[model samples]
Target: MLIGEVSQRCGVSTRMLRHYDALGLVKPTGRTSNGYREYSADDIRRLFHVECLRTLGLSLNEAKRALDEPDFAPSELVGELIGHTRARIAAEAELLRKLERVDAAAPAQWADVMGIVTLLRALESESGARRQQAVLSQNEGASLPVEALAAAALSEHDPNVAGALRWSLARAAGEGLTDLAIGLDSAVVEVRRRATVAIAAVPTAEATVLLRRALDDGDVMVRSRAALALGSRHVADAIPVLLGMVVEGRSDVEAAEVLGVLAEVAAAADVIVLAMQDKLDNTDDAPTRLRITQALAEIPGVAARGVLAELADDGDRTIAATASAIAHTLDRRKRQGFRN
Candidate 1:
């Protein structure tokens, strides 16, 4: 087939095909007497494989390695690529969360009109320079151009523009953008809120300090957001505060959510283990006990395994099932590690 036929069939532009040829990615099977490129069936098949790899986000160089090395398993490479993509997504998600809070805090008038315009303007400016910086904070590693574009989009005030920016930000977060969580200004309430949500999505040591400060805010809303954000960091130091809220505070639902977040961040088995122990021993609230057990499962560490084993024998079938599942996962991980 000629270049045009291949481009039309494969959905790749002729320019891209030419570039691929230049890079020795997919050479023509032969050349016409007139010096035009001619692709054989094998060349077309190779082009398809290249296209697939590109779709998977592999750089040409990376894809070339996979193609050239017959023993190279695309599955393994794809798994690694997926991990990278997830990190980027997480970071971008964090950015979207921050933007959402910005939108929420903006005056209602802005929501109706000029607000989106302002956001778009801000995003456009950032998109030019700070995009990479923002995305780099996430684990996914954002490039300068992409980050700049995203920041520019985010700074716009037009609701449509802001919405698009938000979408891009969310995608960047899903790709594991973590940069926005760093060096946040706690003095600004909106900034704090955005930081809180972003930190919750991707908890870090620095975020713990910010969250702790927010938890101490005089405003209940600030305190709630802070407490909720602490879920991602899973800092044991915050446990006493979280426990107090759950036991004495009016917002039981919020407290429960905090517990759930803590469970995700918990490294020490006893923190959640002891919380579950307390809830089980003193609280006749079957529902609450079940909730605590579920949270306990979120902690992933060796200590959790022991606690889970103990809980598996609990009288409550629901708790027992959760504990059994956790124990099974831990055991499987251990076995896999041993084999490795």
Candidate 2:
């Protein structure tokens, strides 16, 4: 077979076959008359081998060594190729994601495209200020990338940046909520807590469901934050976790305030008062008992007032004084017709 025949049959161009010959990777087996290059069966086989190695991301030099070196060990080279292929795949995937995010922004001009790219980079920047600016610059009607915002919100460590990212994620109209949900199940405890915090303000039913579910989260902080948000939403289902916060003294002040709001509902009042009483009965921790006493101040009606009156004579002097003070305040508020 001649060079043209080998090129045609082996799917390699004639120009490339000549370069292969020049590199001594796959030389022609013989020369035909009038200076036409000729290839024997072994030369065609070597060309096939070169093409095969190239498919595995081998350079031409590496391909020659693979074919010609008698003691060439394929294991190390193959492992390196695998690593390179994986790196290329990851780079391509990231590029695809960047392109998708940019497309979603729907930039109106080259300047807008550049601006969006800049903001995207800032979101991943090492500086928290830049990340925060990226989030804060999002316009009301602009098509900012919600997925990036959600991801940034979950992973953000800086309090200021996390707040801005959460704000932006909510402004995305819940589009990124699904991605944020992944953070709720993250192996990192802080990530799970952040996910709940970000979702807490979304005001969507899906966020509500997630917040409610997080009421049962293994992390106490997750449950407390989720309960606090759920409480603000007037969700009576959070009463139990809110009570648990009172028992645990974790964010008990805020938890008690939310419980007070929920206590406006008659059913919530009963559940909240009963759980507080139950915890008080089982625990001898003074601080927890005091927290429970203060939490009672938020609850209204006869049942809570009765609990306060009984606590006024409690064994602990601080508890007794705190309970007595709350009762007097309630009486004064009642006299002034003040109610939550």
Please, what are the lDDT tens digits per residue for candidate 1 over residues 1-340?
9999999998989999999999999999898899989999999999999888889899998888889987887788889899999999998997786566445434355433343434333443535333333322333332222343333342334444444434445554333233444324446555445544444443345546656766766555556666666654566556655655555544655665666566665454457657656766787665666665655555565565666678799888987888798678767887999999
Query: What tens-digit string does per-residue lDDT give for candidate 2 at 67-178?
Result: 8899999999999999988999999999899899889767788877787788788887898887888779866777677777787788888999999988887887788889
RMSD in Å for all candidates: 23.3, 2.9
CA lDDT, every prediction? Answer: 0.61, 0.88
Instruction: Report the lDDT of model 1 for residue 308.
Output: 69
TM-score of each: 0.37, 0.88
Estimate the overall C-alpha local distance difference test score of candidate 2: 0.88
Q: Residue 310 error for model 2, in Å?
A: 2.9
